[model samples]
Target: MKLIFLGPPGAGKGTIASRISKDLNIPHISTGDLFRKAIKNQTELGKKVQQIIESGDLVPDALTVALVKERLNNPDVENGYILDGFPRTIKQADSLESFSKIDNVINFVISDEQVIQRLSGRRMCKNCGEGYHIENMKPQKEGICDKCGEELIIRPDDTPEAIKNRLAVYYESTAPLIDYYKEKGLLLDIDGAQEVGKVAEATSKAISK
Candidate 1:
């Protein structure tokens, strides 16, 4: 199942993508993770990405496209893979289409208000990086990480103001992909306001059909 998971910040696309990837036995390919791994390994591509990042400039689309192409060629993607954060633009989508055809594009739908609330309430473990929300998903102990017994902190970008800005940027940059895939007859919309399990079930059914 070559799939594209698209959504704004706090839409739970990553969680849903991880679940679907596990269920289908396909690798979950996230561009951020790929960049981090490449940089950590200090490969040739990693050096170029590092230089671009250190210069505080966005990596050029050609480099990004090349990196993704190299990743997709890995053996783990032979069956398929779940794309979490690629094709953020129509141009990138065009680049991807040149190499591979996506079977389904899951567009997660959630309101801007809900996105702000969900992100603002989220906290992460400083030591182990586990995530928890102040309301929806809480840790065993107050203000502490259940896994690593470390302090939990709200990320700076998770604040209401920052989240609102993120939502605006997402709408501006990534929302167009919804229509792009819809026109291609590969878009499947799923309500992201529901409980996690319910959303997962709906997504599974939507893609199955």
Candidate 2:
């Protein structure tokens, strides 16, 4: 299934995309993962992305599109892949049409208050990077990672102020894609406030249709 997952940060796009990808036996391609892999391997594109990120600027559409296209060329994506962070703009969405056709776009809907609650309660292990949610998925120890036994910390970006800023940017930049895909009859809206498993089931039903 050639699918695209659209959601704001803390909207659980990553989790839902992963579940769908695994069930469908397709690769789950995320822009963030691609950038991290490139940077870790120190590829030519990685160097440029590093510079752009260090300068506190967004990666240009051309560069982001190029990276996505490169990833789409992988053997695993031969059948199809689930895309999670590319095409945040109308231009990028148009650009993707040139190379591949998307079958569906799953849009996870959540309120700002829910996002703040979900993200603000998130804690990550400083040593192992394991994540824990205070209310939903707490760690065994009070504030320690289960696997590594290290203290967990709330990332600065997980703060309410930062989450609100991110939401503002997302609405300003990515909200239009909703209507764009809806017009194409490829948008599938799912209530993200539901439990994770329920959301996944709903996503599966949406894709089946």
lDDT by candidate, in order shown: 0.91, 0.92
Residue-wise C-alpha lDDT for candidate 2, range 112-199, written one tens digit per residue: 8899999999999999899999999999989999999999999989988898899998998899999999999999999999999999
lDDT of 1 by residue, 58-177 (tens): 887788888999999999898898999888888899999999989999999999888888898999998999999999899989899999899999998997778878888788988999
TM-scores for the candidates: 0.94, 0.95
Candidate 1 clash pair list: none
Query: Model 1, which residues run further than 4 Å from truth?
Result: none
For this target, which candidate reaches the highest lDDT against the unseen true structure?
A: 2
Superposed model 2: Cα runs more than 4 Å off: none
Residue 89 lDDT in model 2?
Answer: 91
Predicted structure 1, TM vs. truth: 0.94
By summed lDDT, the worst window of 10 consecutive residues in model 2 runs over: 78-87
